[model samples]
Target: MVFTKKKIWFSSVALFILVYSINFMGYRDYFPLFLLPVLGILMIRSKLSKWFLITQIVLLAFLVCYCLMALYYGYFSFFAILGRLIYPSMFMLIGYYVAGFDTPKNLKSFSILILLITGSTLYGMFSLIKTINLYGSYENVMSALGGRLIEDLWGNSYISATVLNSSVSLGLSLLGLLFIKSNDLAPNKRILKIAILSIFLASIYTSATLGNRTGIITVIVSFFTIFLLKLNSNIKGIIRLIVFIISLYILKLLFFNLNTFGVRSYWESSFIFSRFENSKVYDDPRYEAWTTIIRNFNENLLGGRQINLSVNFAHNLWLDVFYDAGIFPLIFLVIFTIISLISLFKLLKLELPNIYKGLVIGLYTAFFLTFAVEPILQGFVVYFTFFCFLIGIIQRKLTSATY
Candidate 1:
């Protein structure tokens, strides 16, 4: 195949996603930086969207101003803060560069994303089992896996993983299932879906092992949303639903029933289960952060205060926008997000393949769940950039069809 501009764009973006998804040795953190030269070239060649350009300009302005304020106040070093902001600020560019094309048209187009989802999931499972073997107790395992002490809004302390946020990666991985067809992976599509579903099921176990409820819930939401959106009253759909639920249950049983080497009891006693077992699940600290930020919005209307001093971030995407760059950028982002979501819903109704539609639905819900509580725009740059790139494709398709 000739490496046309479109192909180059797809390959680079796909490779970026794959590298970040696998996250081997923390390369995920810096891979985007390394891709700057290539992406910059593509950006120059691509016809940028007006909406994207305006939004990027406004966001960049706010970021510069915010960093200046942080610097003057001795909150942090100016260069360090600005350097960190660089990757996140590239989201608009990522979106605009790929907006001219459709979503990947063939399996080859989606291969890297597939490898990302399946490979990361398998790696997560392996990490969980390895942790178990290395540390016999739940507490020991969690601490060994880079967990740190965190207190909830209610002052309940538990160990939460600090090094890696597995939920986002896993949630993003679930989107790969959207590209799969019944006939693609196995003897039939049904078995293929089930096989991938099984990998994700074990990922739930991995989440539980790490005491990551968000990861667990996001996986369930992804599965449920994709199926629910595709649900019709037809008999075949009903049968698939039944089989899906049954398969999920059976998969769950198989994972937990592994009695060899006391793994079953080990899983049962893990921090995730123990939290629920003791009814200590409602320990959210986001409420406090949200309230404080909202109340202080007037104080920081022109420029945000240093959020790192309090909760590292506002803990909500919109609130983080409000808290980090003030109301102007917040308003722009909110309007942009609303429009993007409308585009997503519109894309779902179009005459695309079920795989693409499911990808749209699954990724939207999964990311929404994460974006609501976590500071995705600033904190999860790689995932946010990929999301922007995908949404850009949606916007592009919608615009092209209007003509």
Candidate 2:
């Protein structure tokens, strides 16, 4: 029995490392993505705890409701909810990985993750450059050719806001450099961190698209939060936070009007707010979405009616959930989020470096804002899986009296 558990443990770890190495290369499709969960479950005895089982059943109930709605509406053919399950089903295996292993040092783990990001970005940039040289601007680039080229070369969408959000938030490499500088690690480690951050920053700017500015600004805020959080909670620390907030206020004064402000976007004419004074169309899509959830409350309480409501994406995740599931899912979501945050915050008693705390806190902070406008439920599995595992890591550390 002991030998068997040992083999499962080691094999599962090996599988995780192998799958993680493939990283961006195999992220987009089922075979590679599904590999993790399948291996994870096989190694772990094919049984999750009753807690997870019950949770799955709950989600299953939601699924049945959705399927019934789909059958009623005649849109259940593609097996969408079932198909989408393919993504999380893969990561659920990873959750078992977290359940078993301790969190390794932040340095190597995050370095591997960021390295994949930097590599993918470079691949995308090179592809873009080649396409431009061969076919010129977007006007000349054919969608079929461009898509084939994007998938073949980069594996995922380069300009996706959620993808860019992770790379750009606190600058993956930049925070890595801060880790090196703060920690008394060897000189080579320090240099590696700095070098990685430099490449990451350049790539983020190159990948800039519509909402890039707000994302960059959020990164700055989160980065500053990290630096300040590191300072002892003395008068000096409070002053630093104060200064940071003021700077953010100024930035908001300048730009928040353009993109979304808590699930709402101002008219594109924010610069000329005066010109559109009377055109009060506060009716953002979120309101309509919210109404949908409210209306469906009696029939579909646990989540939305599992029908094929979204042909593609909700475009806005927060509003979509609120609309589909009513006010309760948001409440459940917020509570679960608070649990994650509070758990991590207590783990901070371990006094993790400002760099790591900043990295975790900043990324969560950035995602909090980003998800307001986009559903990252479909983003780099690397991001979602890594974060989930980190939570498990922190919980384990706290429980083991590591502090």
The positional error of residue 301 in candidate 1, measured at the CA in angstroms, is 3.2
Off by over 4 Å in 2: 1-27, 31-83, 86-108, 112-180, 184-187, 207-211, 238-314, 322-335, 378-386, 401-403
Over all chains combined, what TM-score does candidate 1 have? 0.71
lDDT of each: 0.59, 0.48
Q: Give the runs in model 1 whose Cα sits over 4 Å from its true position.
A: 1-13, 49-84, 89-112, 115-138, 143-163, 166-169, 172-195, 232-268, 277-283, 295-297, 300-313, 377-379, 399-403
- For 345-388, candidate 2 gives per-residue lDDT tens digits of 77567645555555566556655655554544433434444444
Query: Backbone clashes per model, in order?
Result: 3, 5
TM-scores for every candidate against the unseen true structure: 0.71, 0.61
Candidate 1, 111-225: lDDT as tens digits:
4434455555654555445555556754775465455332211222232342234433444436446434544223456655665567567666666556765676776677777
Error of 1 at 45 (Å): 2.3
